[model samples]
Target chain A: MLPLCISHGDLVKLFVIALLATTALAVASLFVGVSEISFFALLSGESNEKMLLVLGESRIPRTAALILAGAGMAVAGTIMQLLSRNRFVEPSTAGTVESASLGMLAVLLLAPDLPVMMKMLVAALFALAGTALFLGILRRVPLRSPVLVPLVGLMLGGVINACTTFFAYRYDLMQAMGAWTSGDFSAVLRGRYEVLWLALALTAAAYFAADRFTVAGMGKDFSTNLGLDYRKVVALGLLIVSMVTASVVVTAGILPFIGLIVPNLVSMAMGDRLRHTLPWVALSGAVLVLLCDTIGRVINAPYEIPVGSMLGIIGSIFFLSMLLRRRSRAA
Target chain B: MIEFSGVTKVYGSTTVVDDVTAQLPKGGITSIIGPNGAGKSTLLSMIARLIPCDRGTVLVDGLDVARTSGETLARRLSILRQDNHMTARLTVHDLVAFGRYPYSRGRITADDQAHIGRALGYLGLNDLGDRFLDELSGGQRQRAFVAMVLCQDTDYMLFDEPLNNLDIRHAVGMMKLLGNAARDFGKTVVVVLHDVNFASCYSNHIIVMRDGKLFLQGSPREIIRSETLEQTYGCPFEVQELGGNRIAVYYT
Candidate 1:
């Protein structure tokens, strides 16, 4: 036998290192926004209320939102990959993110005064419906190659995005809707971003069922043979992905490739066992998004580039390299 | 005992396995042998609920495979299919440990651990237990899967083409091991095999399938005759008694 080389202690040590890094980045994020907080002035009790207010209300909430959004989306991506039996798929690929944005648009158009919680619910329901439609289409397509499933998902997402955009343009709500669809942390005030804790709750639920998800990832026959209700597990997985997507979309819009990139990175280091690798996925996700959002804030100083656009650039390059690696490995 | 009643599988206009109704005997190694498109694998799959039959039912120990709760049925029956593809970087030990998921739900108890150990030992895979499945040779990988099915510890075990990549020695070892598992444990083993002579040697009962139908089923001695062999294969086959075993010679 292999003698259990990577012990539990090693994993604990790895987690501790990741945790310390994320904490440092979060601390740095609190200090880097548009407002300049003079620590020396505050310590001398000069009574700069504006710096304290910005630090308390804006930066703290933005940092927390970034961590929650990043971790939740990354965990969601891992679950989506497992349920679909494909590595290239994510919440965005499944059309769930666009569907959630569509739901947000519908609520904004119809009941503009709806509470934040209600908006989240509406968007989550739409996300669930959208993911169901994507999965239904996926079922019909022959899964002969590893690349086909993700391609179908991207096409499904594209169709949904097109429909949503068309409606937004016609109603002249495109400007307002566009802000909610692009991921940026600038507007994340304390009261505005608390809804993302629900995404964290969804993360917990996924963790509880992590082993089942791991088994389910091995394809239907294997999971069914292991006595898993494959359909039910998959449905639960979709629901989790939809809620996490909806929560992030409502709070920070879509942070494009954190989910896709985070899980793959974690898997490269930790292997594919969902239970063991999920914490690493969440940690890496939180770290990656936090670091990127901080850089986005500082890159323009007073003005900010959207975190989603930043991730788009980083995520695509990472994704392309992964694809190349797989091709070369296969060859 | 597994009872297949009027089992049929149709794809588009053609039937893959058409109306196979028979009882697989309990507590012995039964081999289903046939040509490439003879529905042998399909029929075995239907019995294990791996494939839903189009027009009939499969009963294992009086519980209909299609309608029974998967958890309950899983405890009684287990199946190993031919193509075992996975994306995980699992060692042989890790893969075998998952065989206990039906019972332990990923929480391997001491008893489950014991079963895993025994299965590895039974397959003589203990030495290779720590190696990743991708690192192992094809024959070793094949044995690892067989070990997993055995570790499932179900009373009724079914395998679809378990000897695909095995060399001659391992193939013979596999047949004898399966035969011993059946005889020693009072287990029912249903295997689909392409080699007729191996079937004649190890199988307590032989079933020949041709063109989606059951062509012949009997003891090795009765089913190993030249007439039955020729009819099943659609070619001339010579049967000879060698070392007190019935052997079928079909090659040029």
Candidate 2:
């Protein structure tokens, strides 16, 4: 009933705080790796080569990868929610990450000598196909309940994950390819993680067409009545979601919950207008992932747990509370 | 003028709208009253091009509804369907402003705001403009959607079951406003209604559809008679003249 309980100036300041937090976590992530590299050490010209190499090849790239994968996946989730008109949709809901993993497993078995970029393209293509399959199913069956879409998408993703696991085990790539498919930033180097920049680019494109996504989310009749090309806008949303998911899976593996939680949180605070909420979603996603990655890096000191494991732990609790919150709000 | 040549709509083996041809006169309240599954909503949806017709073509002012560009058709015609559910959290003013999207895209001009204000005033919704749609009751939300369509300022306006969820006072007010739009503004208005008495009172022309076909079409004086009412509804009816309006009672 109240129009924006939060004032405009306060919203801007909150975002500034988020940016500050993300920057701090990014800097902290640089120093928390196995090698001892601090900002003071860099200022003292102590890197000369080791710190410089660590910062350039390892730390900087990891931080950027975390931010890109986090921000991109979150935006993809937001767009998916808009496109499906479902608040619970995440990038992984459409089986994109599992499909990318399947593509990577196939490349590992069939074309072992291909470069990482080729593998990324293959995985992205597979993600697209998988996403198309899920969307096709959605169109065929009318939803009997609001929860049906997400449930179907989750089961679909599980089936794709089973296929990916079968291939990974059969090809003896379970351990070798597992690191890249499970949200580990340890493998990211300057050249290896460049694919995530493509995800970043697609997120920018989603922002450009934010209003179209918002209108299309209203339903087909509403969109057509407003003179918007509903099918085209929906296609654009699916494309953006698939590309973002694939790039993240190929580059940093499957980071969970960033998309589902970030967009919902932003929309709860700022409403569903894409332009206003997208920046906040991106920022919140980046900050959350940066913090999670930091916790993963420092939790064991010198040894790292994958960001996937960290998010899988923290994200589940967050998701449960969110579900409960929604129930309470509805009541 | 709107013309439908052999318009038919089907779902699987069931025909929702049988092949029919009719020319709707322009610039007045034309009420389409019919029994359930008589294809009233289907016919209205076809005119709006929200649903594709299986056969035939509908022409509005010489422009084919099926073939016209959405932008071109949107400027000339508008339709509000039943079951208006919106997922987005928008205020009444914001929802009404969306009417100008066909004209200004998302950008709001002074002229658009003027139309929005006038529509809100017309619906007695000026005080509720700042309230979110979800915060309003069902009747107010229904009125807000109707105001949005009115703000669109199209030549031909069509509404399907606009009185749903509305109480008697709002329902009468809505009908009077729609009738006035047809009379004072020279807008062609078509509405699908279940209440034949309301249709008899406000409509300049009344159409009765039965079993997916045009059962009858005439002025209220011609269509509200005992024989015509009984035949159209498959029930006995008592017709009475009240305040110069032919009111029908089909209690038997």
For every model in order, the TM-score on chain A comes to: 0.95, 0.93
Q: Show model 2 residue runs off by greater than 4 Å.
A: A1-17, A44-48, A321-331, B127-130
- Residue by residue across A22-105, what tens digits does model 1's lDDT show? 898898788886678775777798848898899889988999999999999999999888777778889877788889999998
Instruction: Tell me the DockQ of each model, to 2 decimals.
Output: 0.57, 0.55
Evaluate residue A288 in candidate 1 and report its C-alpha lDDT on the 0 to 100 scale: 90
List, residue by residue over B57-114, the lDDT tens digit for candidate 1.
9999999999999898878998988988876656798788888989999898999999
Ten consecutive residues with minimal summed lDDT in candidate 1 chain A? A1-10
- Using TM-score as the measure, the top candidate is 1
* lDDT (10s digit) by residue, model 2, range B1-252: 999989999999999999978989998989999888899999999988999999999999999987888888888898899888776666787788888878988678999999999999999998998677878999999999999899989999999999999999999999999999998999999999999998999999988889999889999888989898888878889999999998887765
Residue pairs in candidate 2 whose N, alpha carbon or C atoms collide under 3 angstroms: none
Measured with DockQ on alpha carbons, how good is candidate 2? 0.55
Off by over 4 Å in 1: A1-4, A38-47, B127-131
- Model 2 - which docking category? medium
Worst 10 residues of 2 chain B by lDDT: B85-94
DockQ, computed on Cα atoms, for candidate 1: 0.57
